[model samples]
Target: MGESPHAVTSLPTARQAGCPFDPPAELIEARRHGPISGFTHPGGKPGWLITGYDLVRSVLADPRFSSRKELMNVVDFELPPAPPGEFLLMDEPQHGRYRKPLVGKFTARRMRLLTERIEQITTDCLDAMEQAGPPADLVTAFAKPVPAIIICELLGVPYEERGSFQAQIETFLNGETGEEELMAAYTATQQYLAHLVAAKRAHPTDDLLSDLTNSDLTAEELQGIALILLSAGFDTTANTLALGTFALLQNPTQLAALRADPALTDRAVEELLRYLSVAKSFMRTALEDVELGGRTIEAGTTVVLSYNTANRDPERFTDPHVLDLRRQDGGHLAFGHGVHQCLGQQLARIELRVALPALLNRFPTLRLAVPAAEVDLRPEIADIHGVKSLPVAWDA
Candidate 1:
């Protein structure tokens, strides 16, 4: 009922050594103390960190917590409004306007229709990995390319342009690139998307972007939407594939269960989603004073919703830290919740369902090539969490 004794002074960057899948120790400790803890943003603004499953889900669904970029009061300076069609950072009518048109396009049934193509994509990546032999960096050979190609095809990006597009995306999302390099990659991507939007307008094709060309959305808006889809479509799933593979190898019992019963693939994917939670945390600003977890979140204060910890909350899931492929609990926030929940989640699910099993089945002896500690992980600063390179090897 009273304020938590713990106060998070800054965002944690490093995960505990050898515990790559766990949220930062400080965050887990904060959750242990209580669901909501006092937090001081890096920029000196006071805030709260919501680490409980129920509280995080509540904040996500509550309209009183604003998602608008400009409304976030954690930083000292005013933030620019979200670019057009980036509905993740917007709210209400505007978010609905951009999202409603695409809702039907990404439903579970619609994404399932793409299962055949996704299988082929997964198969192709595995074939390439086989030809190249073991000790391959799965991040490049399999994880990154599988989703990269699928998203490219979905957006109607030509095969010739995909390599460059993927490189630019890597630069911006890698989380370790210099500021200048990051901005350059961002600008190049925007320019390319702008050009792609124009091409789609002039010569409509059988792709999601081209389909949107018929809508009332402007080219700029279309470009913004394309950027969102491309980035979200590729990065999150790629990380899940690589990181999930790593988790399975470490938990042979779970891996063997999945391998023995192919029907368990869907459940395994859900368990991995809850375990890894690579998307990590998200920020929301309070539109007004709101009571949460026995504390008041003052108006204009920003709060960090810790998804990783919430997904692993003890009160929510039994043996929360263990990786249990057969675990029956569902409704993880891996893809998030509420109005701004991931648009491409079903597509992501399809890709994971097809790709992960295909990779495991293709290489029955698959395991890490390097020491588990040597596996390079993306820094916490990245919007998405994942591996930089998953070095893997299997018996030849």
Candidate 2:
């Protein structure tokens, strides 16, 4: 409860130059000082930043920390509550209400069922990349399309509508667009989802969205749920694919190890998830005065759980900075922890498991077309961290 001297005045934004995969150096330094550091949010409210693995995971699983959007006290102005069916920002029963129905749909077994289809998608993408010859932007040719198509099919979106749908979602999440463009993209997505949900109600199909239409959820709720699924399902995995490939090309030893042994794919994926931590930080507000990492989190205090730094905490993983494909210590918070953990994590794992190795096998000589430093990375302000365009080449 006593005042600590190591309060970070502001959240760190810039990652160390040329080290796209690591957390900002300031964060790593913060962790070295202690697991928890006092922090001041950009909006001028005081809070805490949790950088230790144990502390970050504990906060995620703790009921005392509320995820409700409106409860976040870091900002001066009161925030609106999350929309219906957008469970990520809601707590307890409301969160469970929206999440429970989807749990059965995204279970490991259910997701694995889509493996063959995902494999086909990955293969078809690689085929296009090959046909186009060398010097292809992997983001467009392979990474983006693979997840985009899979998610569209899962939501039963008509094949003809996917191209525009994908573009709109990209604009919504890319984080670089102006406020006007961002809202326009979001509005377009919402409108489209409304139409899609109505179509599903009148004529249900075998897809996840259609199945959800049969539930007690209304058209508006279904639209919200579909929006969450479509955005989360597409963006995170897409970034991981593009950024993971860039990471591998940078770490030839790890990539070569995976190439040498096919079984390493699973471990490699886990390690990559840990190393990249592309989704980055999440926020939680203290419901009551609580002690965390020897500090008192006052009631209504907001804390930023730095996932990337936590995943790299040396106490949690030995040599945490190194990307070891064969890493066995696998409890990383990339997909997150607790009740609100990512719903599509299993699907993501399957996509990465199949796509990365397959891409490697298909093009044994694949490497970045530009120099490592020349690869364009998404801005730190972006919700997802990844390459804007991963220009890659392979022997034709």
For each candidate, what TM-score against the reference? 0.98, 0.98
Provide backbone clash counts, one per model. 0, 0
Segments of candidate 1 deviating more than 4 angstroms: 1-3
Residue-level lDDT for 165 in candidate 2: 88
Model 1, 130: alpha-carbon shift in Å? 0.5
Q: What is the lDDT of residue 149 in candidate 2?
A: 96
Q: What residue runs in model 2 are displaced by over 4 Å at the alpha carbon? A: none
